[model samples]
Target chain A: MVTTVNLTALRRDIASLSERNALEAQAPRSAFGFGDRSIDKVLGKGLQRGALHEVFAAQMHDAGAATGFVIALALRSSSDQSPIVWLEEDFAAQEHGFPYAPGLNHLGLDPQRLVIVRCSSPQDVLKAASDSLGIRGTGAVIIAPWSNPKCLDLTATRKLLLTAQQTGVPAFLLRLGAIPIDNSAVTRWMIRSNASRSSGANAPGHPVFDATLIRNRQGMTGHWILQWESDNHVFRQIEPVSGAVVSTPAHRPPQTRKSATG
Target chain B: MRLTALDERAAKAGLFKTMALTDARAQFENLDIAFASPRKDAALLEKLADWCDRYTPLVALDGADGLMLDITGCVHLFGDEHQLRRDIHQRLSQHGVVVRSAITGNAAAAHAFARHSAGDVIEDSALTQKLRRLRLVSLEIEDVHLAGLKRAGLRTIGDVEVLPRAALAARFGAGLVERLDALFGYAHHPISPRCVVPACMVERRMAEPLIVMDSVERVLHALGDELFRQLQQRVEGAREVEASFFRVDGEVRRIGIQAGRPLTDTKTLFRLLKERLSTLAEPLDAGYGFDIIRLAAVRAERTQTIQKSLDSTVQETEEIGGLIDRLSIRLGTGRVLRPHPVDTHIPERAVSLEPAVHTAANPPVEWAPVQHPGEPPERPVRLFQPPEQIETTAGIPDGAPAQFVWRRVRHTIVLAEGPERIAPEWWREHAGALTRDYYRLEDNRGHRFWVFREGLYERGQTTPRWYLHGLFA
Candidate 1:
């Protein structure tokens, strides 16, 4: 109360901090990309490497779509020497078919490079995922749970994120037919199958996905229609179609509400 | 009641072996003695033999009360023959056991000399002279033979030695001659060790029982150094090493470490063993602490001499193999794995995770060839075992489904292809088994599904149940 305070200087400090934050968010810290504008453009930066991403589907039939979405992301960052390891936490193999090497080979992905770890419970799967992702050169580790397990709490999610970030390896949590609550993942995606476009009377077109960003740290929640190119191992943008929208309290873009008062 | 044996203190108080326990008590009025059980004595002898194994692996039971140690080539390890004998005597004395030890070249001479005269290493040339002066009891011959020698006025080994060999044999039997030959270092005397003798072995005897892990580790390190030295001499390395810890309370715990390749360096050997010890599910139990620890190379192989250079590719492979070996020790051998391929159409049976060490030695695996070299895939990337049963409705009886309800979700198929028929192998499949008709169905939501119709609808069958087997990219 006794000293004169510069309100203009204080305002300048707040503006400069926000500017630095916006610039810092531009580099994804070594994350790999999905090669799709709908995701990359909204993120402002690329997909973050050495971070955790959570993905879940709404129904059992959509479980396959959820898994494919994660596999595409994992394979994008993996190589023949250091491939992705998938930890099957529950009996998801019975629910959504095991990974077939022949089908994978046909898609130009080497199944031999993939290592599958079958664990008994969700806790064991998370433990295995944490251990595997902690390996320095291991590209990515995937945890696929058959259902929404009550055992996956916030602390467990944070542990996975810490290990992945410490070792500089990405970790993907694939939830089958289960909506996940909030945790430490830098990004959370709810992926579901979108109706495919037909090229001819009998020929099927490219695989398409209705991907919704549920949680984003660097950007805002958005929805996009993405198509998978099997030959190129990339995802292409598709024109937004009707009825691809999922509603749940209409997540407001958090950054848009900021009033600069400039 | 009768006493079978007496200790020195009781004997000093006018007690003796085979005397009536009541009579001995009556004589001293306070003779502290108990009925000697033979079983307890045998157990003690067995433990003593196991304890003596730390000296040389060549320890065997001489009789009810004696242990024979073949100290040949092992004497230098404890400084010299006399020093080893002194050390053994001192250790036993400290254990409250009255012990007499003789370090000799021959087992029989050592056995005979340990009881009479001075328990010392007699020169090889003076062995016969030393035997001549010993009493007949020293020869370790049967009691009947000793009795016969006494009756024949040959009360000592010299008396029997002077007699003609054939005459001596004719009188006391050939057993006397074999005993003389063994005692005089003229015949072979082999000892059957209680434990298997490894290719190379090193051991450490603790003066004080080691109850802590650090002490065990220290002993293991010391023993591993000696073993590593021996392995170096043969220009070979140990492929599998076994470490045995003998507890003071008579329990033996063994830990074994297996390497992906032959390992000789002491640092690597000790490091691997330490990792294995720490990772054991049931940790090493040292009840009452261990008195002796032994390190032995159970198996060995010729180590390939690599031309050491900055060639990192070869080094990387070796480093990875080492990492796998370390991990297998902790996570179990089955947990650490490498993908191996099989030449089969059944997907589950086509690929499996094998122990990483097995694949580490073999050449890189080649995945199955693609059907259409470079085309966008029409099949799903992931396939599951026991294809999941899905409720799908088809237009024609044998045709693919235009719409299907799976997991409570109905999808209308917009485009579909494939009727790739896969019949179960005739020899492997039973008669009435269905030949599968697989179809790639693309629902309106671009959800690609691999649905297979089992058996033909015309073959006296109900509605052919469709199973969803895979999901393509």
Candidate 2:
């Protein structure tokens, strides 16, 4: 006799199976960000430890801001004493500039725990990433290849992902000025220079960024206005429309608007 | 081509340097020949000099092919000067490296005798007799001067010794007399050693050469233990430790470790050394094998703690220090850096980077933690290395911008505060230097920025410009 399968029940069954699988593999193979529920929820319980994550910028100018965001993530992952190895391709380092330790330390990521390695090419970057992934006591391994390196493809990223999984180390891949490349990254973030909103008016206030969750393996993609709270080392989501809206040509004066004048 | 060099076999067959290659070939029809590489020979000599460190720590490369060993107080360690020379000769010969070694009270005398009277040991009292027996070539003077002397009936040093010092000085200039004085130990002649002299050193010379990392590690552990014992007896600690591995192939590999604090612990030293070796960019090549390993405490300091200072925070601090040391070693000395804020108003000159391991913010000048009670942070968490130029328009001539465009994104100012004037220090003012009016601005959105307007309207011809100096995060 032929029987009709219940698809919804089958979906439920698979979901439960995955939940049990997570529990089985729950031997300290988990990472959570900043202990903030809002970020943890967005990141699907802290970025899935022992996995590769991608942080990219929409344009070349946003590389600095993207770097800052990535650094924040690394700082969140690493303890004060544990070191974070930042591997940058030679070209990327040239374009984006070297990491300024004093500024970074001011931003609350312990400069003492950050190790910057300049690799000649993307292949060298991947090689260093793979080697650093197995280091047991480090906080995190971060790599940013040249804008679009020839060898920074899905195959290489997949290999890095597997290594991260095996060693229970978190690796962040920064794609400077490049759009998302199809890979096995658990999450992809696109950060740009968003006008920072602050609570106070006169003195400089907290830094704010409009971060878009471009890719999410386990959940839906979303956008948020997040402010990095340096003191607390946590991120707060600011209501987007409430802050200063990025002015378009429509917001400009009549004399200054070229299109309108023309 | 001329025969610039000849081996022992060719020398025995009556061939000498400066002889025509064609004549040498004609004399011995089937003679084996090869090209000469002076660079390679010099490299081999340096390696040999490094190997001689096994005899004494003060071994220096002498000229092109000789090594000067200051075995002054070290001779007794190897029984005596004659025994040390014999040991060096036998060991070098076994390695197929023909060597001539001599020991004497003076450096130049030892160098001269090593070649002319190979394997000779001349006591301080017997120096005169030895100088008399040695040929004029032993002085290592110029060939032109030596030929002049030879033509003048001075075939041996004895003939030159009998002559007045003024005569030799007049004949070959003052250099000849000065060299003779140096050779006879009448003047100072100190050989500059290839490596830095250590403060206190302990060495282990293995009976059998070791080629594996395990043996090297074991040797390092034993040396560390012994060093710590000696340091403890003196109530001192090592700040800098250098390990010299004399490979049997004549190469010397040096590894140095600097601790954040004074250290005399063997285990910690060994652990740090192991980490360093494993992470070395150039792997230690124990080609052939390493027969001698020397550990030197190049810098030492009195231990702060007589006994272990038991404190929870102190332990934590030490652990942090250890981590920094390891990371610096693995990465590089300058890779791991900490920022110490300078008391400056200029945004760019406000901080300096220092090696984190040694200059970390120890309690004294800690940058007052970023957030202050009710006051907004005067400084931004992240400052642009070079303040980025911003397009801004203001209601007042020298006031905060009412609207600013950054990276092609415009933000209308909702609230503004500042015009806090920070004039350039007269002593530090440059051509572009001008009085800056800094403003803290809040856009229609809650976003805040630390922007500045430089040069007042009448003060400079160009309109006051705006800059986004730092991000207030």
Candidate 3:
């Protein structure tokens, strides 16, 4: 009689586990695409709407490009009528600069639709970001921390992720001057600035970025060179030019190449 | 040095104010003495006035040592005028303060009665008779005017009042006559209150002091309901609301909440207040508990009632506004801000961040276009307020830099865009400012920078300086 009861309990546990997996698979998740077919295909149609995505600058100088990429993602994921909340650390503002309204407008975001919260510390940024993400009507939240702060642990990121999932508002965590660390994010990206296609007479064209998917929960990681079309508010694949000559490094000597590569 | 003030013990020991320290010490070998600070005395008086807010909203500072409470319509709340005076004196005395108080038809008479005769509630019928018995010093005239009045055989207010016509004005220069009229209750003398009298007010007096937050919140909600009911009668809404907590021991704590729009909902007001109280730097110390809680609408505005609609857009706007209010209260109002575009050519001044609670009510302004249809952005994504100076080597004086060093990194220019000349606003205060020539440059590693050279080399200025103003995405 004891053996029979144990078997029945074991069967019930397996059945419940499978049922939970099935329910998770059946849940509907709406995603917004990057407009580039290649990138979207790898992302399984598009990026998930209500998930925490981490973006890191390859180097400190690439902060501007990383910021632009996040803003473009925010604009794409949410409607124009809904406001985007930006939580920035005071150190980051002092190191990089303040987000200029005209520059944000130049990136196709209405300056009026942006609400900014300037915090003195990373902990405050996290606190305000969590509060903003819990609200239902917020379009998206952008949290920018200057460097790797001790307060930003796995637990904090997980809390932010759970709040985002519950409220259906996407959150982007932008890290400048920091390397990729342990986080509970759906996707992680490393961004570097790419040379834009110069217009006539060596004039720089639209903004371009070399975005590397370092980690993806549901798909394989990939890299791509994407150009931002501000007028259309979408990211497009860079076109290949025929017979283009590669320019040599003017500042670094050839002997340093091996060490740099290593 | 001379003594500026004295306590009861020192006064009983024959040490009056303005007496020399040596003389006082000679009179008593070991008399306790302390140097007086008029500033501290004034501060203590101000605090006492704040505590007196429990009696009436029109409490004002009467000198460096006294408080004047105008209880015109508030006398009925505490039984009667005599009962109110007794309540004030008893409460203050329990706090270990030497108390003297009076109630009269006007502030000047009340001031005189309190200083001369400790406790008196004089009626209007006896105002003239009371004024006649007061001495000339009660009028608070200058020493020179007092001596002149004494030499003229004017020892009391009645002595001066009987002779006041055109002759008194000529001798006292119209000041003493004004003081005499004010004492007789003929001239108006209003006391300037410490706080603005709220448009609508409601209060709750608990028999038992409240120490728990739950009870405090309950009392706030009840007071909010009563305040809203009064506001609804006139079709008005509050823009700012203040809650004053009078502790059992003479301590007052005031918390104020400001809304983006005129607020009429009691639930919203309570929620905002709860957020503010929870996030305060120093939590409310309900030492001994609060006996009196008062809520007042300090600022109100006319609000038109709108019909409720089924559209989700209206509900969404309201939800967003509520979120803004909560965030503003939690993180101070100045921390949460909305970007406002200012019409100017300078990049930093073009956008000003105003507090979100204020800008939410005003219509959005038009932002100047910063990008062209087919070209890159004319402005950078992030701009430094005061541009950082950089070292650069331009191929020519009028051309863009070929190489530059910024923040200890050397960047070789791979591509460059021109000389978008933005001249200073010569029509304004920057008349002597030099014209700047800006360039958008891309380095070999592909980082873009917006750098400008201040002053033209051909304009007969000294060596031109280059600055990295912003970074492009």
DockQ of each: 0.28, 0.14, 0.58
Docking quality (DockQ) of candidate 1: 0.28
Question: What level of docking quality does candidate 1 show?
Answer: acceptable
TM-score-based ranking, best first? 3, 2, 1
Least lDDT summed over 10 consecutive residues: which range in candidate 1 chain B? B311-320
Model 3 interface DockQ = 0.58
Name the TM-score of chain A in model 1.
0.78
Model 2: colliding residue pairs: A196-B447, A196-B448, A197-B446, A197-B447, A198-B446, A198-B447, A205-B472, A207-B473, A243-B445, A244-B445
Model 1 ranges with Cα > 4 A deviation: A1-28, A145-151, A197-205, A240-262, B1-202, B221-242, B257-281, B294-327, B373-379, B403-412, B427-434, B457-465
Query: TM-score for the first chain of model 3?
Result: 0.88
User: Any runs in candidate 2 off by more than 4 Å, and if so which?
Assistant: A1-206, A209-262, B26-31, B143-153, B166-171, B208-216, B245-253, B280-290, B306-311, B341-352, B357-473
Q: Which ten residues in a row have the lowest lDDT in candidate 3 chain B?
A: B362-371
lDDT of 3 by residue, B1-94 (tens): 8998788888886778888989988998987777788888887888888999998999888778889888989889899999998898889889
Question: How far is B411's C-alpha from truth in model 3 (Å)?
Answer: 1.1
Please state the Cα-based DockQ of model 2 relative to the true two-chain complex. Answer: 0.14
Sort the candidates on lDDT, descending order.
3, 1, 2
Q: Candidate 3 lDDT, tens digit per residue, A46-154? A: 8888889999988878888999999999999988768899999988988887888788898888888898988888888998888888877888899998799998999
Ranking by DockQ: 3, 1, 2
For candidate 1, lDDT tens digit of each residue in B1-473? 78887787887877777788778777888666665688999988988887777677787888899898777777777897778878888877877889877767788888888877668878788887878989998877789988888887777788888878898788778988988888887899798777666788887778899998887787788888889889888988887889988887655677888877778788877768878887788988888899888889988777677877875556645655565566566556675565667766544566776776456556658787666553446567677677878888788777889788877788777678878888776776678777888888877555788888888878877878888888865
